[model samples]
Target: MARERLEIEAPEVAVHLDAQDPESLRRLVLEACQRASTVRTDHEPLVDLALSQLVRGTPDDNLARKLEELAERTDDRYLTAQEAADPNWATLFRSARLASALSLALREQTRSSVLNSIYEAAHASPDTAAFYRDLLL
Candidate 1:
C-alpha cells in the first residue's frame, strides 16, 4: 500500500483572508452571512414534508392508527426540537431592522449585542431576515 496526503482548501474562508481592503472584507462578510442563512433553511423542506404527511394521513383502522400514533410521537419530538432552534418573529424583525439600519456601521466594523443577535437570528432563518428587511424598507 502507498501512503497519500491530501490538502483541502476552504474557498469560503479564503475569500475573507485574501481581502485587502475594508470594503472588500465587509462585502465578503456580508456574503458569508447570506450563505449561512441559506444553509440554515436546507433542512426546512424536509420538516415541512413530514408535517404535511402527518396532516394528510388517513387511518384505515386499528393497525393504521397504531402506526400513526408512533409516527406522531416521533414527529412531535422532531417539531419540538426544530421549534427550539428557530428564532421567534420578534427577534427576527428587530434584528433585521437593526442590521439594515446599521449596514454602514457593519461595514465600519462596529460590534454590539444587537448586531450579534441579528446575525444569529439571520443565520437561523434567512426568510425571517428577508421578511423584516422588506418590512423595514
Candidate 2:
C-alpha cells in the first residue's frame, strides 16, 4: 500500500477591527492617512479633494457630476495649449484628471467602508488630517 501525503496551507490573516470604538478607528485612519500622504505624492491633490469631499458629506451624485464637468472642461486642446504656455501645466492637468477620477470612484461606492472607498481611490490619501495638522501648527 502506498502512503498518501496531505498538503496543508496556512490561512490568510484577516484584519480585525474593534467596531465598538469608532473614535479609535477614526484616529487610526487619520494617522495612517497622514503617513501615507507623506510617502505618496503622485496623487496627493486628488486624494485631498476626495477626502475633503467625503468629510463634507458631499452627495455622491453631485460630486460625480461636478468631477465629470471639471474633467470635461480640461479637454485635450486646452491642456495642450496650457502646457505650451506654461511649464507647470502638465502637473496641474495630471492632478485635475486624477481628482476627477477619484470623485467618480467615490460616487460609485466601490468600497463598503467610507475610509476604504477613499483609500481605494488613492491609498493613504489624507486631506482632513493635513488640514488639522496645519491648523495646529
Error of 1 at 81 (Å): 6.9
Q: lDDT: which candidate is best?
A: 2
TM-score of each: 0.23, 0.37
For model 1, how does the per-residue alpha-carbon lDDT over 28-90 read when each residue is reduced to its tens digit? 334433433333222344323332332333212343333334334444554565577854443
lDDT of 2 by residue, 19-83 (tens): 32554443433443334434333445656765576555444676566655755565453487695
Clash tally, candidates in order: 0, 0
Give the Cα lDDT of each candidate. Answer: 0.35, 0.42
Q: How many Å off is the CA of 45 in candidate 2?
A: 13
| List of clashing residue pairs for candidate 1 | none
